[model samples]
Target: MSQQRHELLPTETHDELARESFVQALKSHIATRVSPGVREIYDHRVRDRWVSEHGAEPADRHEVREALSADTYYRLWSSVRRSSQHLLWSSVGDAVTRQADDLAARARVADAGLGTLRLDPDLEIPWYNAEVDIHAMPGGYRGEYMAGDVSVGAVYDRGVYVYAMGQMGALNDDYGHSICQNLLAASYPEFTPRRILDMGCTVGNSTLPYVDAFPDAEVHGIDLGAPVVRYAHARAESLGRAVHFSQQNAECTDFPDGHFDLIVSHIVLHEMSPAALRRTLAECRRLLAAGGLMVHADFAGYAGVDPVTQAMIDWDTYNNHEPFWGPMRDMDLVADAVSAGFDDGAVSIETVLTGRVLQTGKQQRAGQLTLLVGQA
Candidate 1:
């Protein structure tokens, strides 16, 4: 019996190493297989369309498309693979759960902290009313959306994307904020913001970045989910960031009129319905101090990309449970922003790379479009 145990132990260790090696190899293989074709598609279809229609320099779209395509492919692949691995992890988690009732106890403690906030579950927020689990998260944000239930919304947000590999889907909201900060700093150097507000900041991921970006300014974040707000506040506190998080709807915020120098939404707009988006935009305009800027970082339609790229973006909306995404992308964001009260010349869309740089034509390419409003 002792000899058998020793032999099995060595075998187990070998298997673990082999599995890890296989995963790494699979990632490398997927990258090599998908990247080149994606790059070609971007260079030909995406770049040509942007330059021809938007008056961007020739080859600009090409370079941008290559970088963006790689990033998108990597993110999508990682998420899918992670989901695949979850079957194993889930069983392991179950075993761990059995062994350690401590996790449950911890979750209960977290739940207690969230109980102070009153959230209206029946309030019927239009943006969250969707049938499909957007981004393939098993339970979408609205599925278990509840106040005082720390595990529901919080779990859904973290778990739904559990299968997503390597911070794919930006892992957490903080990553999204970091992306925004980097994009703004690199793309729009002229805009010096003083007061910033991040809407739908569930965990202050989007809110904390602004605080870091502009230390001189006051940063605030608001969300309707009380548990999420509580969690966000706790997280921010733990991170040693002084961010003011409130439980409120973005459409009708408690903030004073014209209070913020910059109003930003990271991946929040598309979740909203058309009417809600319009209302949010109007609220953004109303809350912006005169000459304050609104920087919205989200999806733009793949009008110029190849059929495959277009299909990939659209597939997530249909297959991955993002019902509003397709509709949101179809809407004219620039037009919507203008209708909300920004001047005609105030809004401009510029692309930035979300992934590694790759070869392209002479023109510089932007990976994703960042719509800057309020000034040129």
Candidate 2:
């Protein structure tokens, strides 16, 4: 199935939609049919060769990569996986570019009087963001081609649904939805937040869930991209969600100290540099009121995974333009949070099952999301 259509999403031509669907199918095939072979090759072929040479299995993800790099099957699969990513973006980008003017116009009139959008032209884009197109997404998240360009945001809103292979639910909102429904409700039943903030809220996919989950709470979302926040505000307004959208760096937002009762981010930490990640955690501490909860959700760290598995998961860092993926996995998030002024006892990492399952053409995959949770 395709992504749920919203006003801010570009209208794909019939052929464009088919191309996007093919890309999705190819990704699903890779995940189900081709990717599983990596483990089999590593367990039997790569491991046998490594043991013959060094008298022990690959010691770390580095060695695991070295071993896999030599295997013809692995190389072929890797090439295909990388190509698929480029194709995914090309397919989505074309659709957005085709209707750039239309999208900008729609964004201009999308307000349903639900929320507000604030932008900062002088806000410097971080070096990390300005230097790389994090996902090889064309023009990245901040590109503004025209006076009121929302094309990049439209592309992202559609692209992520495909990139996640529909595992993030129909609206690509499973992360925020799951956190609110599964984690917060069970953990802090009596804690009612008056103001909530979502950090690195690209296109506001994860930010909108808070509006539905906490109807009375004042919800806000922040991102470094001007185009993204512009589209995010419009998207929220079209969806009847009252979410304040702003263009600001998460590491140094203008919100006053103790301005929020709850802070959350979804899979955004891996996109940041080490310094930014640390500063953001500290910023979260500063923005949160006493007894407030801070939850940054992303993939779990690579402390206990097998070497081969780690290498496999880290392939994105090398192939998909996610430079910080591997480094982010190696970080000690709990310790970092403590260093960010959180009490040692107040922070911990927990893994929670996704509130939804990924359904792909008769295949169902259950997923787990990790949380770096802290309390102020």
> Best candidate, TM-score-wise?
2
What are the per-residue Cα lDDT tens digits for candidate 2 across 1-376? 5678788988778999899889988988888788888888988889999999999988899899999999999999999998898999999999888889999999999989989999999999999899888888887888888988998899899898877767777788988988997789888888789999999999999998888888899999999999999999999888888999999999999999999999999989999999999999999999999999999999988998988889998998888778999999999999999999999999999877885565434577678889999999
> Where in model 2 is the C-alpha error above 4 Å?
355-365
* Reference-based TM-score of each model: 0.64, 0.95
Per-residue lDDT, model 2, residue 359, is: 46
- Give, for candidate 2, the lowest lDDT window spanning 10 residues: 355-364
lDDT score, candidate 1, position 214: 80
Candidate 1 per-residue C-alpha lDDT over 1-376 given as tens digits, one digit per residue, 9 for 90 to 100: 0111110011124544344445444544444554345556555665566567667744433345333444555456546544444443342233333423332233334332321233444554544644544455433444433324333334433332332232333434434544555666776677677778888776565567677678777777777655556556655554556777677778887788989988877777777778888888888889998778787767676566654455445545644556677688778878888898888878777554453222223333434445544542
Where is model 1 poorest over a 10-residue stretch in terms of lDDT?
1-10
lDDT of each: 0.56, 0.90
CA RMSD of each candidate after superposition: 10.3, 2.0
